[model samples]
Target chain A: MSLSSLPSVSTARSTASLTADAAALPPRAERFGRALLGSLLPLCLLALWALASRQGWIGRDLLPSPGDVLRTTETLVLSGALFHHLAATLARMLAGFLIGAAAASLLGALAGSSVLVHASLDPLIQGLRSVPSIAWVPLFVLWFGIFEASKIALIAVGVFFPIYLNLASALARTDSRWDELAAVCERGRLARFFLIALPASLPAYITGLRSGLGLGWMFVAAAELMGASQGLGFLLTDGEQTGRPETVLTAIVIFALCGRASDRALAALAARLAWR
Target chain B: MAEAVAVRDLVVNFGERAALGPVSFTLAEGSITALVGRSGAGKTTLLRCLAGLLAPSRGEVKMLRGQGRPRIGYVFQDARLLPWLSVAGNVAFGLTHLPRAERREAVAKALAQVGLSGWAHARPGELSGGMAQRVAIARALARAPDLLLLDEPFSALDAFTRRHLQEELRLLLHRVRLTVVFITHDLDEAIALGDRLLVMAGPPGRIVADLPVSDTGGALLKRQVLALLEGSGEEALQSPTLRVLAAHAG
Candidate 1:
């Protein structure tokens, strides 16, 4: 809560705080207590959910009891079905993210660095970004034929737009004074991009990547729904077709957990890499 | 002293209007030339031109260049160190051409020169304004440039920090065989740091006066520079004899 605890970025406060005794951070136990406090609302919501299911406030067909969903999850795990489905979806998400991020970064750099490139390419990119990613699913299935490639291609399309948007804007917003420094130092174009533009845009690029990953998760469900046999999306469809609400609830819970976990991982990585 | 950088009737245009120029001057190698002017006088425009960050619309800037010579080292008003880089990495930014060992040595030497050898691994965001400016100086010195260009490098610091840096910078430059083009509006700072003074004036900025800092007559020179900036005073600008003589060692 002290100024010293804040990141020393603003020149005035940072300078003044330079001589001010650094305020000690809270003890480990107190810090841990604060973290636990953050989960209070989610835990309360889960308790409400359990009570509603227990009292049959929602019909069993509409909302399965929490116990039923947990039992279903355990059965799926014991049968190794959950692992197989979850692993398949994670693999697809990773592949889509890697492909999407690479392609977006290349095109984004082009657009951001040159006004000519932005003029020539931004309209098309923006137009494409405006299209709902799910709209591409049918076309991708038709072209790649309901295989892993089609699913990956669809997710990649979803991931591409946000990362591309963030990176282009971030690069555009980079401080021009560094470019002046590069010119004075006689650095080449490539050097300027790598030395100044790249690091300057990294925090935003990571934000874009995190959003792209979430979008990829959304499309992964849609991707698997396009006739996947072994995935969480397939499990959802199977639960619905078989009229088992608990199975569907189990899949939803897993999706929530996985998405939260991935985002948290990325946030931790950003903390390490953002401003050094 | 030898000629290190020459500006010949240089002019820069921001659209149709002239922002600087028909400005001409020569930097004596190993000498510190302080350019003094009012805020709108375009000292920065001229410095940018000399630093090759801006191109002259008319005339040119010719620097002494040859094999093994590095490009110009520039320091802006603020520290401007890349926040992500460590002190050593920031100093080593422009030294990528050197071998790894030589680069390390140069970074160490530069940091040491600024009295920041112990803080080589610290982040710029962690430093005070004075410390950050010292790191900026180290970054410039690491390149071992023959010519260094500074645009009011210490103007953002507190008065005490500013005065302290001026003294430290003067001593540091004295130890190196480097020529400097310093831009500042403060006549006291200019006189304290420079061997020669160039006074600039106007929208289409031009150097209206040139004078040397005489060790015996600091107050007199300060008054003259103030008057020149105020469009009144000494005729040293009118005579070729004074202009040539001002380039000599202080």
Candidate 2:
């Protein structure tokens, strides 16, 4: 029961040393493991689906088999219809999310640093943040019509609060001692912000950005579902109208896949840039 | 001799509570002074005021006598390094006015003087407590300031590291002849490191004692001087450490 003697300190050290050595050489093994995991995940999901369909675990009409969904997806891919719809969704998400995140960071820094600014605007922002972006759909429609403006507005609203709150909280947590230290060092106010405040707040800002992207994806889909002629959501609506369960499942699968890919890409980019 | 630091009627108050002097003190040019006191004694407060990190509630801190630029270097107890910066970057943070090559060379020389040549690229988080403190000292050293203010710079360090750094500090001061004011609760540290010790005590801070110490001064002289400032305890003169420990224990 006791295998305490199996790996001594030296043994553990050598093993760690070997791993470190391998890690120093381009990370190919790590990349291969990631690729293998990526490939296996969908395969496992498909196998589960096939088993379910064969046994009639769920009604075939409601939940199409992976094969049926794949056929629909392949057709859409060949026709480049999925690509067109995906591009539209991505464009809206990126544009709206960037605009919301930038404005929030700037305003958040201002509010966080100045008590007067925070006092003037904090109650209004808190009230606005509490209201869901989806609840604004009717108002947005009236304000900007059913075009892309409404969708962008909804997505921007969804993404704004998380980024703003996170950034503001981060800036608020900035130690006054650091500012005093900077003054002692004779650094200017702008230099102090760039060197200390910005770097210190980066981790919190990144956390906010990550959460905002999730909300953004959710809002974009909801906006499309409520009103859109051509999108993945529209395709789902089209499938429902046509009475094609397979096409509906294909559209849902594509939406999930794109969302996962975007999140993964974001995580990868965050890994590269984030300090801690 | 030029006046390194000239202060007149320096007063600092935390609301109604007084922290430091309405008293006056002059720091002679290129001399080391130690500020000593019990806990909550305003030693650190006085050091901070001199460093320009804190403005006096009422008083003038004339760092330079007339026209020359007055650069003040600082070494804090915790070695408050920027976690994200490499040792070289942290050391060179204040030296932007210098050319890039000169700055790098200065950082390199400062690190070498602190016996941290190998740790130039390491992050502060990656260093030991002693190493981190050394880097902080190197950072101040690199600034080549007119006045160096250290607040318990080596109190947190291990005994061996503390002794080594004390020696290093003594040698660095000899080479650069920088004016320094160090704060410490330790009497031995004050005696060993200071050219003059200014002991401040209680309520509205007033200088209780001003004792001059020299390299030639023996342990007996140090004990006698500290004993004089600490007030009467006939038995306390035998051993200063034991006396201080006994007083604290009681």
Candidate 2 off by > 4 Å: A1-48, B64-69, B96-102, B225-250
lDDT of each: 0.83, 0.78
For residues B176-197, could you state the per-residue lDDT of candidate 1 as single tens digits? 9689889986788888888888
**Interface Cα RMSD of candidate 1:** 8.1
Q: lDDT at A181 for candidate 1?
A: 72
DockQ of 2: 0.20
CA lDDT for candidate 2: 0.78
Off by over 4 Å in 1: A1-30, B64-70, B232-250
Window of ten residues with lowest summed lDDT in model 2 chain B: B229-238
Q: In lDDT terms, which candidate is top?
A: 1
TM-score, one value per model: 0.89, 0.85
lDDT accuracy of residue A80 in candidate 1: 97
